[model samples]
Target: MGQHEFSEGVEVSHSQYGRGCILDMIASQTGGIDDARVLFYLSGEEVTVPTYSLAPASEVTSVESTRGTLGTTVTIDDGFYTITVEPDGEGTGYNLSLQAGNAILDQAELSSDKLF
Candidate 1:
């Protein structure tokens, strides 16, 4: 997949899974190796899945209308990633959020970005 495939505001579906909305896409160094990561909400749970395992957004046919929002920005030793909340703008703070595993290696903020 190209870098543009990880763009914000994209919807996708997985094989054997119902559907999921793309929250944040980031690249980071893991154990001296670079890896692409994609964070998304699945079945009301926050899941951080590898970008390589994700199918193209167009191939997903069971996509839902639910959208995601950028909640916060997090930075670690190797790289940085963002926190995302589902269902768009809903409250003053994020009740649920997800971040890349590599991005949570250090202290970071939750809900750094405002919901639009």
Candidate 2:
């Protein structure tokens, strides 16, 4: 892909890292695309990678959500990332989680109103 500028919070994909969200970006001191880099969060870890090696997260061309007896599961994968919402064991609320492959980046319990 051609060199392009990216800002914080943008989701990007790398050939080696899969999908990640940009946490910060450092401009090249020499104003060279080869030197510019970005700090991104991937699989629960923060990593810095060269901008040239990344591209805007491959478009999420297909998304699927299924509701079953167990819970609701949503898959939005450009070959990465799955989000899940399930009833809290207590039956009081729903638990939401964001996952990339096997890494759970965030999980939270939400009340009915918050979930809907």
Candidate 3:
């Protein structure tokens, strides 16, 4: 749960590619490394990069936080999705709601034990 992990339609700058918008963010498995395969609009090629390497673009809107709790809303990439974290009785329990413009596409209830 780092800041700006990756999201669609977010503007960003690359070390080599200069400037681009993130078209997609897909999980990649190489050498057992959980990396993010990002597609940049400028290069038009999907490349894997560490989440820490990306620089946020000034134009695209994003929400990032080091601290979050119930009723907290985490928005990413100009409203591509809104993730809500709900409170639960168990200290480790987590209930998430994923929304797509007033339409909830998915919801899940889990505990810290379920998530590594």
Top of the candidates by lDDT: 2
TM-score of model 1 vs. true structure: 0.38
Off by over 4 Å in 1: 30-42, 62-116
- What CA RMSD would candidate 3 show? 13.3
Report model 3's TM-score to 2 decimal places.
0.35
Q: Rank the candidates by lDDT, best first.
A: 2, 3, 1
lDDT (10s digit) by residue, model 1, range 1-116: 55556655665545434345666655565542123333344455445666655666556332223433544422221111234334224434443343443343233223435544
1 or 3, which is superior by TM-score? 1
lDDT of 3 by residue, 1-116 (tens): 24444577766765565446666565545443344556766458878776566777554356664345453434453434467665454566767777756889899887876776
In candidate 3, residue 107 scores what lDDT? 92
Model 2 CA deviation exceeding 4 Å by range: 1-5, 33-42, 60-76, 82-116
| TM-score of each candidate structure, all chains considered together | 0.38, 0.46, 0.35
In Å, residue 88's CA in model 2 sits off its true spot by 25
- Model 2 lDDT tens row, 1-116: 45554777777777676777877767667865442234444556677787777778755435778786656656565646677777665656677887877999898878765655
Model 3 residue 67 CA deviation (Å) reads 6.7
